[model samples]
Target: MKLFVYGTLLRGESNHHVLEGATLLFEGIKIQAKMYDTNIGYPAIELEEGSTIVGEVYEIQEYIWSSLDALEGYTGNPLTDMYSKEIVKVETNEGLIEVIVYTICDVSMKSVLIPSGNWIEYRSSLIR
Candidate 1:
């Protein structure tokens, strides 16, 4: 299976260690979804027509999903998990393809939206 990572799992980020052995299929890709800044020091994404969210696609080894699931706080319960793995089509240089991505689960309407879409850029701006 494949995974689309947007935030800390990007090339050079704090949580990127979780994907150490994963093969990067696409360095940059965009998801037609809305992005938001969560209070928990991470970004969140949701399916929204025409909206774009920048991320990376990787072809990971089998059994790595459990580690990813733990990092994403997904425990098979969509009702209370912070994120849930969902299959969505992302636009890459090669073409559009269906891939599993971890999206924010049961987010509140009051969450702040990240208009820039790119988490790395958005996160850097926060420090300045």
Candidate 2:
């Protein structure tokens, strides 16, 4: 399955080890979503029209789903999960393809909007 990761799961970020052995399909891919800083070391996204968010796409193994779900606080229940998986189309060099992306389940948890929509860039800005 293809997974789109935009936060700590990205290259060089914390929690990236979860994707060990996965094949990177594309990087710096943009999708229609609004990103936020949960203020908890990772970022979350919400599907929003007219918004573009940057992320990476990877071809992950079936076994990785359990780890990814656990890390995202997803328990297969929308009412309880902090994040929920959604299928969305992303433009890649080859073409447009659908990938599973984790989106914020609770809007109230979003403390600040990440205007750049790129987590890595946003984090760098904080350090500078």
Candidate 3:
């Protein structure tokens, strides 16, 4: 299964170890969605038309899905989860591909919009 990661799960970020053993399908991919900075110091992606979220896509082993789900706090119950995984089309250099993405299922409106759409850069600014 392929997964698109836009925040901490990306390479070199804190928490990136969760994706260990996964094959990196594409390091540069973008999806049409609104990116925001949550109060908890992490970035979240929300479904939005005509907006872009930059990230990477990985083809993970089937067994890794459970760990990934747990890491994202997804329990298959959308109503109470911090985030929910959904399949979305991501634009890559090869073309568009459907990949699972962990989106912010709640507190979306409360987050500050990340106009730059680059979480790594945004996160770097916060640290310095």
Best by TM-score: 2
Clashes of 2: 0
Cα lDDT for residue 6, candidate 3: 89
Candidate 2 regions with alpha-carbon error over 4 angstroms: none
Better of 1 and 2 by TM-score: 2
- Assess every candidate by TM-score: 0.92, 0.97, 0.92
| Candidate 2 Cα deviation (angstroms), residue 44 | 0.4
Could you tell me which residue pairs clash in candidate 3?
Answer: none
lDDT of 2 by residue, 14-124 (tens): 999999989999998999999999998999999998998998999999999999999999997999899999999888989989999999998787999999999999999
Q: Which portions of model 1 show Cα errors greater than 4 Å?
A: none
**Tens-digit lDDT track of model 1 for 1-128:** 78999988999898999998999999768878898888677888987888898889999888788899999989989888988888998777788888999888867732788898999999888899
lDDT of each: 0.86, 0.94, 0.86
Taking all chains together, the TM-score of candidate 2 against the true structure is 0.97
Model 1 clash tally, residue pairs: 0
Worst 10 residues of 2 by lDDT: 104-113
